[model samples]
Target chain A: MVHLVIDGKGFQAEEGQNVLEVALENGIEIPHLCYHEQLSPYGGCRLCLVEITRGARTFLSTSCTYPCLEGLVVRTDTPDVLRARRLVLELLMPLAPEAPRLQALARQMGVTETRFASDEEVDDCIRCGLCIRACAELVGAEAITFSGRGERRKVEPPFGEEALNCIGCGACVFLCPTGCLHMEDQDGVRTLDKWKRTLSLKACASCGRRYLPFAQIEFARQKGEDPPAEGWFEFCPDCR
Target chain B: MGKQAIERIVEKYGSDHADVLEMLIDIQEKEHYLSRETLQYLSERLAVPLTRLYHMATFYEALSLKRRGRHQIHVCMGTACHVRGAARILEQLERCLSIKSGEVTPDLQFGLATVNCVGTCALGPVVSVDGEYHGHMSASKVERMLKRYSETEANGVAVCQK
Candidate 1:
């Protein structure tokens, strides 16, 4: 464990955690977005800025990326830190006005409205790169990637082709807090609700009972695959 | 097999660092990662020596000359992630996959790595499976995630179909 003083409050935190982790662990509220715990630290949004002082040398850095050090002094609610955070919010507002989290954070920071203007109209990407990095770094499909360059850059699958490698895992869908990426179960192959089904009664011996699309099961069986077990029902009410 | 390709790359940029990086990036993208053959061809054409090129490639994190598995799992260990149980999620992945960080599965289906951050702190405890982020993850969630991918792989469906 490492000891640090944050916002005039002394606290002890586990070693190797970043300042943001330490602050939050100790109940110090620091405003931020674009810093998902699961994704890598991008430092793109520039929110979560904090002031760290060590022997009078104070500087600002995104707490999400700043690793905690022994005896470090940190402040998240300081005026300077607040000023920097406000500027970052100002820049992000114009990019994603529809995002309630972003809007709420901006309002909390006293940025009731955005002064920044963007001539190029586009959807809510904010370009935080959570989806792109997630696809490339975590999934290994390299199915979807960032294409184009600079401001023109957008996440796209290869040749902008319909994502072939996309297993419909819904990782990207869940990770995208902004609801930018959406998925639909056209074949009625229900996997997203797998967790919910686990809590319900077991289905027929042939097919698990929670729910199964009849057409989909029949299609699978017609393809020479085994149908649901003896006790398993053929289809859910919707399919029937 | 083709001198024309080498000629095209060399003639266009003329042995500069930026040019070399760009050429390597193109080659890497084409082949998925830099191969020995591609590096040799570059070394011969650029006349900058293979050792120097290797050094430069190693210096940049973006470039990977080594063979990468089909899937790369980069768990974010950033501050926000750490507080939000990213470590537990990573541990779950490692346990379920039966591999340590940076190790590819014996079947060549997956590879695991940890990244400092990817800038989405709002979604703490994020897990990127094969470059797709799965946010707000728990140990159970990670297990289900791996099972889903493994099932897809078992089904012989190209894990990344596009």
Candidate 2:
């Protein structure tokens, strides 16, 4: 186990674990978006900053990507860290005012309003890149990505066209923290309105309820054979 | 010419994920802008997804997804340059070219853009035309700079300029 000091408290972390994971595991909250446990860390959102000191050097680093090193000192609530986090929040506020998750985080940080002006109003995709990372890493489809640049930057399918490779696994919907992604399940159809795409769902053989996408089932089928006792293609989890 | 050259570049980069940025730069240098075909070819050769390539292309200002002109003009808008009337220089260029920033002229002779900084604060209010730096730019000097690019069309009507 690797040992480190966070907020003046000694903590032990398993090797290869990031500071954010260890901190959250130890009951310390460092507010962050664009970070999912299953997806690779993409430090696009600079909100999870912590002042890390080692030997004689000290600097602010995003806690999500910063690995736990022996004898490292991390301070999450320092003045500089708070100031930087507030600035990030201020910048992100105008782009996604409708996001409940972001609003809750702003309240926790005591950020009342944003000083900057934003001409563009984004629904919930704050360009934190969580969905992009999830689609690329977790789902392996890489369906969605960031498009445009600077103030016009946004997440969308490649070139603002439909994503041909998206399998409609809903991993992006599942991992999105801001609730920007919307999905609808009707009859046996799953519609991702953002991507303007839809896929067919597999109805449970026993319960006749739509449980998962047919493409996802095929993906699982390719992974390995189903158990002989409970056939994979026949029924959903609840029905089985 | 573009596809064959891009194939050579992919072969040169050798599928190393870390060299994606470098490969993109090289391809952009050769092709002027990243075309759809080039992006798709690079995606397949480098094993990077097309969406990912698009992401990278859009993220960096140096890369352009759309077709650009033969000549590119970059106006510095860093703190030092901004305070030194770079905005007027950019505005003048826009007026003379009849195009906004991130646009190309109808003739496709020039493309206009702004960069945050060029790391040369000493050369405040600098404008780089096709990689040739012009320092201490003013609204009046913009005419001369553009005239250097178009001699035959020097008398072309500017859409709007104060």
Best by DockQ: 2
Q: List the residue pairs that clash in candidate 2.
A: none
What is the C-alpha DockQ of each candidate?
A: 0.02, 0.66
What is the TM-score of candidate 1? 0.50
lDDT of each: 0.67, 0.84
Worst 10 residues of 1 chain A by lDDT: A193-202
Candidate 2 total steric clashes: 0
Candidate 1 segments whose C-alpha is farther than 4 A from its true place: A136-140, A187-240, B1-162
The candidate 2 chain A region of ten consecutive residues with least summed lDDT is: A221-230
Q: Give model 2's docking category.
A: medium
Per-candidate clashes come to 48, 0
How much is A15 displaced in model 1, in angstroms? 3.4
lDDT of candidate 1 over A121-228, digit per residue (tens) = 746667676765665456543345555545655665543445544444456766764556665453334332311111122244444444443433443345454555
**TM-score of chain A taken by itself, candidate 2:** 0.89
